[model samples]
Target chain A: MVLYCEICSLPVEFCEFGKSFKKCKLWLQSNNNEIYNKLYNSDIKSSLSKEEEEKISNSLAKMQLKEERKLERDLINLQNSKILIKRIPRTKHKYIVAIANLDLLDPNLFDMKKTCKKFASKFATGCSISKNSEKKDEIVIQGDVADEVESYLREFIDSNGINIKIEHVTERFTNKKK
Target chain B: MFKKFSKDDVHTRTNVKSSVAKTLKSKLVSQYPKLEDVIDEIIPKKVPISLYKCEDKIQLYVVNNEILFYQQFDDLIPELRLVHKYPDAFPSVQVDRGAIKFVLSGANIMCPGLTSPGAKLPEEDWPVNKIVVVYAEGKENAMAVGKLAMSINDIKTINKDTGIELYEYLNDGMWNFRD
Candidate 1:
């Protein structure tokens, strides 16, 4: 019989119920530790000293803090990172700068319309924002602004002290369209 | 697996010649011969077809605003759910739970997944080297469409790897492709 996980919709064999699927496992640990522990460690009962419990909790907090700091560092590095600018193929030199995974980004810090306007004034005649139904925002420019937009975004974001990284969706490429 | 396509580039055909329509219909019928009876019904006379030449290698065939089929690398294949609309249109094989991740990630269906206990295959006339749809064992929706790399008998008998070479699946360019 085929089995599936209620959580992620993955097949049960490829899920936590079976062997070696870490995605659901990680999701369970983060979202519902009780269920995760029950399913995986249902029979195990552990007795620990007060000092040991305190140490475990402290270490877990430390690990979480470390992860948070690493995330902050990654965000900071994104400001100085080179932007990926690309020309949308099959079009007449129409360019686009796609920024995906917006869910991971702070919505307050990033403004699609504001960024589009800034992109339009410097590089293109005008810009349009394509707001994806899937929540990703794409900024479309009429002309080539790959280089200028990258530097402009880096400087703008860095100066504003917004905890975000503006990355060009695709790698910068010279236009083969004549 | 998906590439962005502009809506402006889609070529809408308001009317298709009876001769052209017959030929196009026949082409689909030839690839999926079992659909010969109902092919004409689905693709009625002068049925509107919107052709989107998105990338150099991929072209999308949209009907009723939903992508019914796609042509990639010179081969025309129907979309998964489109195949599901007519359940018996093509032969289907079910993959066990172990193989869903790889299939969704664009990996070819492995032999073990299909030969596994929970997997199911057609009793007869497995379409080999032709387009067939694949469904995850417990899921009602067909997840992918691929050319069966090996016949069902061969797949069951041969203890080898890589069963179906999936061309398009959920989240692939064809799935997300639209005008």
Candidate 2:
């Protein structure tokens, strides 16, 4: 906790920085040390002139904004840190495929017929969808790897009875690439 | 020593104010080779990974501005070797800020056919403890992810909601949190 003047219960962090030292000097010149110190030590408020009130409010607002910005920056940092990727080699004959902004699904979570593309991305090689997602689903698969990928997904979705139903695309994503 | 600060001390106009920026920047460079030339040397980066080692299995997480490798710290040097040079589990994969950005932008990020959203732990408090990304379709040389940035309506605005939103993309690609 920092000490402040009885006239304004601001955190008197002025001593550390020469820049703010003048403000502390001013406060000390007016108020008695004991009363000022008591007020500073306690979380008490003091009457201020309109101008002083504006300054204090401005300071508090600026601090709050800084805190929020810090929060956002930290969130970005955390997102950058937690984000993961799986390595897939670029091979011939097989093409890697991915979809963005899953606009094809009925977010109502009840409709299924219009959800063709969603299912394709999920069950098919390029799909990577999950129940935890209420929005912003995407899918990606590489090359003819979909067949192998399909088999791969089969193992993960086993036993729980959530076999991903991929609409058969006669021309595999491999043929479409060329 | 944290203290109640006022705007007088803050540089609101110019750049990152975090002390950890430099640390994160270095770590991004040392860990991800492709980004060495792209990142400005004067920004706060990630810590150097060369000194850290993987205690257990590690996952490579990527986002818009940085990449982080999540691993248990047992023998720091060995893990550095594994992630940098000799990756036994998933070879030839390097994590960086661009790849992370690309992934978060909704590009397809690829790894081994198998990947867990990763360890059940929060990096801080967000549910994004582990993410699943794949090498994007069409863009095979790069890695990307299906971003959790936009909402269903936002995706609909673009008329295509089947992939990650690119950061440079003008409309839907930018990450926006909507309830």
Candidate 3:
């Protein structure tokens, strides 16, 4: 049986409940306990429409293919690609800045009009957006100064008492597909 | 876990209150000086906004919606018109966790946080005030009254704590359409 990745919406297979041809490591579980527990104890299992189930299964197949490709690419890159980690030329940040989270911390709702006002008012370098999986989830801010953004984010989250987990990624990010 | 909030010296970005209420969508429309008059060098004629909504949340469009960019705000309708959809807009509804408040009050508000189509068609860069928790009946299960910090697709891509919070006690409350 195929399950869905809650974050990426790609299909996933639990070693326990899914096809045992491959191992599932991205899951935050040792076994398919979360799925089993929910299935056995929840009200949602009975409501699975055939299409919904198939969608999830299709997602799983896609994910499995993606996993294989990613693994192969990683191996190939390890052998040929230079490991020189790229960094922003930290001379001075530009006046306007954009930041992103690897996990699509937010959807880009920046009021295009206000950019001028805000930029004119503040010393931002460039704008970074939250990164999103290809059409899979919300996009996060984008920025090389992710650390500074995190400090600001922590302040916002802390002051507001928000309980959310935010993460950052290294290496340059690709643009989001519309 | 929540940390202590230092309201006394909350070091915030200068224009960092609710941008919608304080700066962009302020109440006293005439009070503030017209920005165009204030700064002739910058400021565009019209800006775009990304809109978000909460439903079965499919197609996490994280990228591609933000043709316009600016500070985040709290309303989604004004931005809705930018997208070519039904010109008719959905009223912005505020609801407690389960949209418990609206479902009780009875405004075509559906979803745990679902309100309706905002003034804009759905876009990733849309601004928002709250997200609705919706049900299969095409009505709201609850109205999660929180600012849309991210776009509709942005929220869909991640595991939202508010969503987790909404689901925690969603079914426990009884519907009271009194409001």
Candidate 4:
């Protein structure tokens, strides 16, 4: 069973990155004060004196310069990382669709939920965007339209001017009859 | 090497027996005798150790709710800034301004990077085989944590021109690890 926050219903792991974390923090304050204290004072101390700030900034500047030199040293090792779209047969006529490498797309222009909703509307009625507990986003459509969806995404991304190469990966589900 | 870690994988990989946790903790204490005083504080009382693989040759340990330490070459090295935020939790060495980029990019640190006016020498006994946190000349938080290649005396007397080994650093698979 997927664990979700009782207050906001977001996945427990992602609660900290979502709005539900604020509610969780409020609950922690009243019910688990010890935990609240631990989380509150967990990170590095934020307060720094002027001299410390100056020293850190100077180090940062020097570090940046050194980083440039390192980058120049390794130009041949660069390799292309591709975005993968996978289709797997879930049932007789249904499919589970997953799109990996969403980081290649600009977040401002690419909305996973909206794009999935639009794509599913063309072929099936129960198309929706679902997120795993780990927060990996996937678009699920009820009916099997894997071929159509793959072509549609290609045209859609091409028209949008994104420079990412997409790889189509297919995994067929095998049923074991006992 | 960086990838998302599912909660299911976490449970599978790290669901260690209590006996295993006890043994691991004992091995850790044996490795770093200085941790005897804070052994209880570092190891969780009842919880099983959660392990996350941070690339090849590196692994992270999560006890209770915090990522307390990482392991390399059979040595358990505690998380520098993330763990033991107390002033004297771990020994530290400061690197020059130019070394920040290389450290973040997962490169082994060189002696030239530490030969700066702002560099803080590691204590005489603190350098050899010890897990020391690395900080930039100006930064308060440690940018990386790594095992030292040379003792303070070796560094003082035999100035090596090349190949100073460091265990781990910022932006390495360990730092970017998520579960």
Candidate 5:
């Protein structure tokens, strides 16, 4: 199997071409010392002349720096984003849980439809992916499982290596039994 | 072609019948005879193949959650990951170090990049429309896969303009696409 760098998700030999070369190098050096030595210590000379090599390295370094900055900006934006789980009172003593802002998470890793199905089975309630007033996709659970959903979402986010806050809100109808 | 592809482009996904999978394996073998040895290992018979019909008539064939190859018309273009697994199975061309960034950005391979001192082309002139893996000057793993826009001889003589129409490359939408 080809060894892949954890940081850049590219083959170890091609890490130099990726945006996170320095991080990939550190990760490889710490995880797989044998492969790291073979890749870095070996004198595999390039065919390009000194000036051409220098120019390419300079441009690559600039591009990598830009990519790193973009990554930092995205992380900051993610930190500001939050998932909101609202428990709305429907009829007498009936409530529904609506989860919003999950799209902030990586859609590739977390599928909204799959998560809806999981919630449906986990709480034995009807759940579906629907668009909210803001035209964003949100999961609507048929019952008041806000607390359960909050804990599950926290676990899910943590498992995916993302740090985001989840807030729970309860809507109180004027004609409530309490 | 797949520079801007995303999950929204996918229209439908269905499992390929075992019989159809057998025919696909044979077709792959015919295209790349070298793959005959490891075809079984690459596409195990027991595992089912998932065919994803995407926008622009592109069809991605996935097995065990990883995309093995994709078809856009008649050619069965191997994904870069698959090419990395069996680098020797496909006809390949190299690009100079300076051209690596452009190729990664989904630019068509220029003739000069292929004929440069750092690059290498096969001795035998492959005809136009041949599918080839693209390797960078210093990289061991293949970075892209594409079809030759012109005959190899023409690329050598003309030495200008587009040479290979890059279909997929490292960090492109298709490469980053996760089912």
Candidate 6:
């Protein structure tokens, strides 16, 4: 069985070649100590000479630094981004919840369709992913479950180690005579 | 070739018919006779296969959300994950330890890298345009897959210039892509 690094998602042996080698090593050491010892403790010297080894390590360090910077930037962007859950009044009392910017949390962890399905089942309402007026994909629920959705999203974000704010907005449509 | 691939590039995705899946399995077996022994294990008969038509006329065969292989034109090139499962099923060459960094970064394999002391090329000459799995000098697993730009014999003799056109490599867009 190929052991993949939980941190980098690369095979354990290839973790050195991945971007998050430091994190991968820590993760492997904690999760699979046997394989970690086999990979890192084995004092098998590389075939490359001193100069080539230094050059490769230097380049790898530089690349890792760049990757770290990029990740920091992404986190900063995430910190600024907010998930908006709008409760729009459709009829006299009926309301629908439209969730926007949920993708900002994390594209990899959050699948819109799956999230919609979860909401549909949990709230016992019809949920779908639809384009908003701004052409951004948003999860539209057919019932007024804004508070429940907000709490669920907050828990989801907190569990994922992300700190993002979820804002609520209520939209009221009034009839007017011209 | 798959450096910039993403989910947005996918145009259409449809379930491959059982008949076509059988033909595909046969085609795969014919291309690499070694796969005959474990083709059933790789792609189970009961599982439904999805064919994703992507940008640049590329087609990807996905089984159970894992991309098994992709087709550019006529050839069905197995992904690195599939190659890792059955390393010996494909024709492969090794590059020197020095070339591993470059290969992982999506650089084409140079003749010198293959002909170097630590590297190993097959004694039997494979013709140009043949797909070959690329392994690092000391690594236990493959790092990339590519097509031969020059025949193996020519690469041995010339020992200069690009020898293989890299298709998919470790950490590239395709390797990191998740459906």
**Cα displacement (Å) at residue B137, model 1:** 1.4
Candidate 1 chain A weakest lDDT stretch, 10 residues: A11-20
Q: Please identify model 3 stretches exceeding 4 Å from their true place.
A: A1-27, A31-36, A39-52, A83-178, B1-179
All candidates: TM-score of chain A = 0.40, 0.23, 0.28, 0.53, 0.70, 0.64
In terms of DockQ, the best-performing candidate is 5
Candidate 3 yields a Cα-based lDDT of 0.32
Candidate 1: misplaced stretches above 4 Å? A1-178, B1-18, B54-56, B73-75, B125-127
Q: How many residue pairs clash in each candidate at the backbone level?
A: 1, 62, 67, 2, 0, 0
Interface RMSD of 1: 13.2
- Two-way DockQ contest, 1 vs 6, winner: 6
Write model 6 residue lDDT over B21-118, tens digit each, in one string. 99999999999999999999989999999999999999999999999999999899999999989989999999988998898888999999999888
How would you class the docking of model 5?
A: medium
How do the residues B27-144 of candidate 5 rate in per-residue lDDT, one tens digit apiece?
9999999999999999998999999999989999999999999999998999988998898999999998889888988899999999999999999999999999999887888999
Q: If you assessed candidate 1 against the hidden native complex, which CAPRI class would it receive?
A: incorrect
TM-score for each of the candidates = 0.50, 0.17, 0.24, 0.50, 0.84, 0.81
Q: List DockQ, one per candidate, in order.
A: 0.05, 0.01, 0.01, 0.06, 0.50, 0.43
Mind giving the per-residue lDDT tens digits that candidate 6 earns over A1-178?
6677778777778888789888888999899899889888887566678898889889888898889899999888877889999999888789999999977866778888898999999999999999999999999999989999999998998899887889999987776543
Q: Where's the lowest-lDDT run of ten residues in candidate 3 chain A?
A: A82-91
lDDT by residue (tens digit), candidate 1, B1-179: 24334454454434445675567777888777888998766665556866666545566766667777777775678876566578778767888755765687688988888887657887885746866788875555677888888888889899487789888776555554543
Off by over 4 Å in 4: A1-178, B1-12, B53-57, B123-128, B162-164
**Which parts of model 2 have CA positions greater than 4 angstroms off?**
A1-178, B1-15, B41-133, B140-143, B146-179
- Residue pairs with clashing backbones, model 4: A55-B138, A56-B138
Q: What is the alpha-carbon interface RMSD for each candidate?
A: 13.2, 25.8, 16.8, 12.0, 1.5, 1.6
Candidate 5 TM-score to native: 0.84
**Which candidate leads in TM-score?**
5
Residue A35, candidate 5: alpha-carbon lDDT: 90
> Mind sharing the TM-score for model 3?
0.24
